[model samples]
Target: MLDIKFIMENSEIVKAACKNKNEQDNVDKIIDLNRMRKIYTAERDELRRQLNEISAEIGEIAKKGGDISSIKVKAKEISEQVKSVEEELSIVEKELDRLVLTVPNIPDSSVPVGFSEDDNKTIRIIGEPQKFDFVPKNHIQLNEKLHLFELERAAKITGSFFPLFTGKGAKLVRSLVNFMLDIHTADGKYYEIFPPFLVNRDSMLGTAQLPKLEEDMYRVEQEDYFLIPTGEVPMTNLYRGEKLSEDDLPIYYCGYSACFRREAGSYGKDTKGLMRLHQFDKVELVKIVHPDNSYDELEGLLHDAEKILDLLGIHYRVRVLCTGDLTFASAKTYDIEIWAPGTEKWLEVSSVSNLTDFQARRMNTRFRSSKDNKLHYVHTLNGSGVAIPRLIISLLETYQNSDGAIEIPEILQDYFGAEKIE
Candidate 1:
């Protein structure tokens, strides 16, 4: 949520930023609402003061055993007026809040100017796509040959887009979860946690997953919980409604959770197998840091995610998300896309974003500086240390040997309990 005071003071600047993001529809409305609310607040406050004075006069009249009927009549009229103003004020505030919620976060100055993903500027490519001697099979096909995923049975049990990992596939899923968490814990100095897979509405809103994108989420009909779309929702809300001292400037944690998504309208796109599924596992990295160091820390978090692809020797590149392509809460985002030899395209395995206090403002997570007692919103950042299904897809495609085996990345062999999957 935006600070209404800031918006009131700098409506012009806010409008320009919103216009640049192609969000002009709500700008003028919000600006006007803010103005009206300002005027109404002044009127209401003045009336409240007058009512208090009348109450004091009435008390004095009673104490002196004098006629208080006139003062009582005036007080009754003022009280009725107050009720009317309060009614209008409530409506104005409601509309104002709705408009504010529609406004996207201001883009970082360093972010490149452009509207679409096509306008996104590339950073650099990490490695070359591998070449295969045989007509390479995609992860889905390989899984079929190796008895890894049982799609037919899964379809019968659950609807389409649900696949059951069995034998080698189940092991691969387990290995990826552990492998990603281990790397984040050791290199990133992050605490590891396993958060609940279900979260309340307020928790979802804190992570920017509610109020706007409700259709994309799965909510439990009878409970205060919605199946968490990602681990970030629960992890970021850990410090919700809490205050931290200056000594707790930077807080980092990596969490693993099974994610659920409705995928309401997605069809004819990545529905073949593990590429697009109803349920998947992910290791998420979330950070709460001081405003001054958030960008630097966000970059570090991005690279920490990249290290998994780095250690696996997978080819990938980072792309800065444009305003149109950015998430609602992110001030800036860098998506790390790994090369999938099977599909001959880059599939995003991670997206690191710096929310720059937008999320903290909503969650009430703040830090106090030693210099002054004033509290300020701490910056929030989150990224997929790496998503499992896509990495699994890339791994099966990139590391497959001619003999129809997968050469385990050296770093993961110890965890896999074997050098290769044959």
Candidate 2:
């Protein structure tokens, strides 16, 4: 949510952002509604003042043995007018709030002006994509040969886009989770949090996933809960509606959770394998930092996530998302795409974004600045400290041998309890 004062003061910039982001918001309508609400607010305040004056007059007249009925009637009329104005004010405020929610955060000045992913600029490539001696097989073929997962049975049980990992596959997923969490929590930089997989409507809204992307969520209608689309949702909401001290200005959290999404519009894209799944495991990294230092924290967050790919020896590239490709709440974003040899494509495994108080305002999470002791919204950032499925695909495809065995990354050897999967 943006400060209405900021919107009114910089309407043009806000409108330009709406255009760049490809979001439709009636800036004029929002301004008009706010004007109406302000008018009603003044009228209500004036009515209250008149009523107070009338009450004082009525008391004075009664004490002085003068007839107060006329004054009482005047007060009653003022009271009725106040009630009417209050009702009008309520309606206008509600409408203004709805419109305000539609306004997206302004993209950072550094963000490229573009309308699609094609416009995004690649920052750098990490390691080179593996050159396989064999005609490397895709994850689907590798899984089939290794008896890793049962997608067919998963489809029967859950209707598709679900995987039932068998034996070593299950262990690999668990090992990845532990390994990632261990690194993020190392040196106590990130506190590992165990969050609920189900979140309420407010939690979704706080993370800017509701009102726009609600259709892509699985809702438990009876409980009015939405299955989390990412660990970011719960991790960021941990301090919702709370204020922290300056000492806690930069809080880093990493959470491992199962994420669910409907993939509503992606009907025929990446339907096979773990590329598009209804449920997937993700290790998420979230940071809450003082606004002045938030951008710096974002780079640190990105490095933390990139460390995972580098350590895993996966070939990946980082791209700074163009304005139109940026997430709804993110002011700026960097997408990390890992190369999958068999798929011959770069799969985005994580997005590090600097929301920059966009989410903090929505969540009402703030911190008191030591400099002034004034409360200010904290800047929130989140990245996938890499999502599991695609990373697994990249790993298997990149590490697969001609003999149909998969060599495990050295870092994960201890967790996997083996050097390779045959």
Please tell me which predicted candidate would have the highest lDDT against the true structure: 2
Query: What would the per-residue lDDT of candidate 1 be over residues 276-394, giving only the tens digit for each residue?
Result: 88888899999999999999998999989999899999999999987777777788999999988877778888889999988898899998887788899999999998998889889
Task: State the lDDT of candidate 2 residue by residue for 1-422, as single tens digits.
Answer: 88888899999999999999999967899899989988999989998998998898888889999987777877999999999999999998998998888889999999999999999999999888798767889999988789888899999998899888989999999999999999999999999999999999999999999888999999999999999999999999999999999898688999999999999999899887989899999999999898998888989999999999989999999999999998778899999999999989999999999999888999999888888889999999999999999999999999999988999999999999999999
Q: Which ten residues in a row have the lowest lDDT in candidate 2?
A: 127-136
Q: What is the Cα-based lDDT of residue 253 in candidate 2?
A: 93
Candidate 1 Cα misplacement greater than 4 A, ranges: 54-71
- CA shift at 1, candidate 1, in angstroms? 2.5
Each model's lDDT: 0.86, 0.92
